[model samples]
Target: MKRILLRLINFGKKLPLVIKSIKKIYRYGGYTAINIASINYGEILKEKKVLITGGSTGIGLSIAKKSLQVGATVVITGRNDDKLKKAADEIKNPRLKTLKWDISQINQIEEGIKNTKLLLEGDIDILINNAGIVNSITFPNVTEEIWDKIYSINSKGLFFLTQTLCDQWMKEDKVQLKKIINISSQGGFVGATYPYRMTKWDISGLTQGLGIKLAPHGIIVNGVAPGIIATKMQPNYHAQEDNVFCSLNPLKRIAMPTEIAELVVFLMSDAANFIVGQTILCDGGYSIK
Candidate 1:
């Protein structure tokens, strides 16, 4: 009787997660067979030239690794030279290169663009606008300095880089596909704090605006809004709120960096040819909850 009771208890504990998985499969229907973790996208990106800003760590680093795995000539840029160098070393791919870029400095970024164009041999197939910072301040505490610092890197910097790339893509022959992905936050869809939220909202808007403008040229633009991804970049307080944060989403967990990276790789590929002008939320269903 004791053994039987223990078995029942274990089953009961695992039942909810099983049910949720079942529901997810049912909702997505046809996509159930492909295991996201094991699926190999090898060499599909062989001909692509990709650039990812802030690609030294966390989600950006994951993207660089995956893109390199799939055989793309990848360039990763970040403000920290040490981190960028470390990432390149860890990745250890001959096709992967690191660039020192502080996107907040528009003039410097423009110069980097010129060099990057030559590095990629005149055309970059994909650009991932993933560099951003978060500054949390209450309304009473907010200041001009805080706002400027956040926007200079997050919104203003991101926009110019996108513009520079789009201009280059426009000049290229129209036969090949070009993609731009802006990383937004779940805060964009709903109200949250100050400048961080504002920056994300700008990302989504820029994606849509540029999506329309670039669509006619066979260039696709989209945005990704992640919820509480398991990254160091999240606020320090989130560590204490693990259970509380898990409760915010139906998945009952935070998303892994790899999950977001896979989504980015998918978006960058020809697989997402039909997807455009949309900010898809990969927040473990946080928005719905």
Candidate 2:
């Protein structure tokens, strides 16, 4: 039977693939091992300096962990000092540095960047604009104050932060591979609400504009729009047993914080060099529905 199976598989002389039973005993040698999704990127980001905003919790903290796993030097910033200290202690990485930064305040932008650079001991090689705020109010309830608050942090602050980094990178004599990853939302793609949705749309546009302009300078700009992720930043509507949020999407479950982090790690990799200016949505299928 073994001989017959081998002969049948090899019968196709020019077939692209020919596989015989692997568990069967082999006189020649052991079966050729195949590994899928086993590529080790642990050292892909070695010696890379990364700055992440709102790294105290939720999606931002997750990205910081993934960056550290990939052997990158990371500087995380947030407004809350206690949360920052807690996060730093939990991670316990010598390569990790925490700073206090609030993206909404444009006046402090230079100081914040300088602080991160000092902690990193060099210019930032990567920037993850993951700090964002969203309100649950609907279109009718949307007010100027609410709109201003959301846009100030989510849209305006994000753009200016990227702009500052871009300006500095453009001044360099030899531009290297720099990354700017903006965290957008599914609301940007679909017609959901008013202010929060409007700000996200700006993020999507900003990603494209920057990607095109920075292509010549080796700065790859991209965005990620995630749907209902189970995180402190966003409210959880249903309990684990109910799984209402998950059912809304085709995947039958809301995304975990770590799941979204995986996508972020991919965007930061060298393999994603060509995926510029595009804001990829990580929403399980909520938008399509």
Tens digits of per-residue lDDT, candidate 2, 1-289, equal 9999888777766353333342221322233221214235768788889999998988899889988998999999888999999999999999999998898899889888999999999999999999988888887888889889998999888888888878988888754799999999988898867888888889999899988989889899998999877677655532222232244666555666676778888889897998989999988787888
User: How would you encode candidate 1's per-residue C-alpha lDDT over 1-289 as one tens digit per residue?
Assistant: 9999999999999999888776654543422121247459878798799989999988899988889888898888998999988997898988888888899998886688877767777578889999999888957788999999999999999998888777877887768888999999888888756998889999999999989999998889998898877676864323422232355667656666788888888889888889998888998788777
Sliding window of 10 residues with minimal summed lDDT for model 1: 27-36
TM-score of each: 0.83, 0.83
**Number of clashes in every candidate structure?**
0, 2
RMSD of each: 7.1, 12.0
Q: What is the lDDT of residue 187 in candidate 2?
A: 88
Against the true structure, candidate 2 reaches a TM-score of 0.83
- Cα-lDDT of candidate 2: 0.82
Off by over 4 Å in 1: 1-36, 235-245
- What stretches of model 2 exceed 4 Å from their correct place? 1-40, 237-245
Q: What TM value does model 1 have?
A: 0.83
